[model samples]
Target: MMNLISNAFLVVRPLEKRNKLIDEYNLIIEGLRSKGINIIELTSKEHLLSTKYLCSGHWISSLGKGVVVVYPMSSLGRQQERNDLVFDLLGRKGFKINDVVDFTEAENEGFFLEGTGSIVLDRLNCVAYVSVSKCSDEELFVEFCEELEFTPVIFRSSYSDGLEVLHTSRILTVTESFSIVASCMVKDKKERKMLSLQLKKSGRDLIYISEQQVENYVTDIKQVKNDKGDSFVVMSKSIFDSLYTDQKNTLGKHGEFLVFDCREIERQGKHSIGSILNDIFS
Candidate 1:
């Protein structure tokens, strides 16, 4: 499976030293490597101030196969996050580079579409579930779908704290046979129904999570399979603890839970266990 990730690039907070954060990031990177995933690091040197922009890394890689489509980043800092070095590195590793779509200028001018974060891709079904937010631009989203030949389903979702849902991945995850979505985050009943129906039609059993659990980031979990094909759900210990007994059981039925403490990284508000890891395929 091809996973997506950006390099550990961030604008250090004005008063905070970045060295420690870099170290923590390296540790997270190491954890991902141990799992046998290929890492694709974006080395762009531009600097932008939005977490949403880092998601462009998702576009730089193929979702499940080796097809590449690059997205433009709206944040100036993020434009700097892309690195030719990273692309060269991936190319050398055997990941085919099919096409590169540059949307950087449009994004810089205000057009936005925050890669995987804004759109939760059901690769097996060729569907992209998106929540319209500041980071998710409808026109650009449709354009992306058209470019990639993906079917786009757009809706509005919000976090318990009333923050516009920045990333679809933060509220929904799809495995081979099941999907976990924080239904509370999705405000529109009709849209939710459409999303659920799409998943059902695609052969994915639906699992719903609550808003409170999502607040703790429990919904931002990643499902991975080891060499033996044994599945495991990787998440932070905080998220694991936030799950109810039933939710835990539901996930356990699909895979073993692998939880790591991320209190330090969480403080930065920039790192997610998923983003920290590199995609093995480049």
Candidate 2:
């Protein structure tokens, strides 16, 4: 119910290509911490072969309600990233990790669901908007929804280049009172109407973005708040810089803006600010 982020956990990779990502992660984490937010660190190790750098492992939102749910990694090397050690570490930190859902067997057969990145969660409304792609499985998504007591709103969202967008966060930005969505990627008019209706029913204003903006990953944003109860919107510098003055002003009306440089991390093409964010509940 709290739109303000008080605590978060970030996962980082130590690979050379991802070094900048760690720095960017640190930058955002530090910035949020400076505002009195608590941050937990989950550093990836070499032994976690299957889980190391895959987006699936870092999609922390799947483990909702402060319950850490580990998804079965499809990639062999990536599976190691979901080592029991990480879960134990979180438990030691006092995080309430419910059951770890093992979909490894299904993953081996090609079924997959990449956590919060693949599906955008409207926590307040108990709805999950999922964009089905190679990394997203319809059956698994339904099962996940059933488990979490969420209603699944599934659709396909593709980029202008004809490639399916990897994560829902790339094209959809949900806030407390408004949701910034990339309508261009949502091809089905009927489905789009349903999505719009759902947002309206949930008391959210829809701010539609063009395909051009989505292509540049300019629509991705997250809402946060400082300790004093002052709300802020956190986004990559690229997204912030690309926003039209009007769009920026509209967002400003909602809250203060906090932008972090993420070019190097984006270049690595694996993680984003949303991927590594795990909500910490006390």
Candidate 3:
């Protein structure tokens, strides 16, 4: 099966950045440019002086073609309609905003799902895989699933500190052929088995990674096609180094690997390749 078409991105330019941050950002920009992907960059008007996570991909989620979901961020600084500017930019680009969930009240009611960061969508199969975390509320997730007509597979996974993983995408990515996941993070036996079974049911090959690899941001990668319609997987050099030769060989059968040096960006807020690349398909 062909993977989701990812030819465009909606990125937000940070208002302030150090020299190293600029270098890292340029590397990602150049890397995508080399692959012939469109980059829609907008400068953030509001200054979040203390926050390092200013990536727009974490706040907006595309439900499907021509429609998108603007999430109520769980982050204190990212909240209070901070996502409107990015959504406004997207609106100008001809994307219709979805109102399936009451975003305005969701945050007041203590429910938050940080777009694609909190859940991984199997768009072809209409399934949303989510890990229950501080940023992902189970009740709201169910409501979203019902309204959006997506099957929600709820599971729980955490970091070594016993804190919930900030984003599910940091540990799991569901693609057409195979899924990369840090199963070790899922502490429970039955839930882990259920997640595996569900992926198998959806006809995806499971590629398991160690917790260390996940820490290295191995699962935080994006799959897209180049301008000539050739498939390519975009990831950081850290992710490439963390992978075993066998894993790389297996992934090579699916797409050409394009690696970038994003150590500086990742160091700031664990935001790397996938977190900044918001796919806007045409």
Between which residue pairs do clashes occur in model 2?
A: 48-80, 49-77, 50-77, 50-78, 50-79, 50-80, 51-78, 51-79, 51-80, 51-81
What is candidate 3's CA lDDT for residue 77? 76
Write candidate 1's Cα lDDT for 1-282 as tens digits: 334222222212211244565576566556655765434444434344544333444444445355655666556655555556655766665666665666556675687765656677777767888888777788888888897778998888886677788767778876665688886678788988887778778776677878776667765676766545566677887888888788788778777777777666666654456544323332
Error of 2 at 128 (Å): 0.9
| lDDT for each candidate structure | 0.63, 0.65, 0.76
Candidate with the greatest lDDT versus the true structure: 3
* Cα-based TM-score, every candidate: 0.81, 0.85, 0.91
Instruction: Give the candidates in order of lDDT, highest first.
Output: 3, 2, 1
Clashes of 1: 18
Off by over 4 Å in 2: 1-6, 13-21, 47-66
Q: Write the per-residue lDDT of candidate 3 for residues 1-282, one digit (tens) a residue.
A: 213666568776654546677667877787778778778787765556434454665666665555666676885777642555666776787656654344536888788888778778887788888999878888877877887888999999988888888788878998767789888899899989998888878776678898899988888777777678877788888889989999898788778898999887688767677777777754
Residue 170 displacement in candidate 2 (angstroms): 2.3
Please provide, for model 2 over 193-228, each residue's C-alpha lDDT reduced to its tens digit, 9 standing for 90 to 100.
787788778877667788877755665566765557
Question: What is residue 149's positional error in candidate 1, in angstroms?
Answer: 1.3
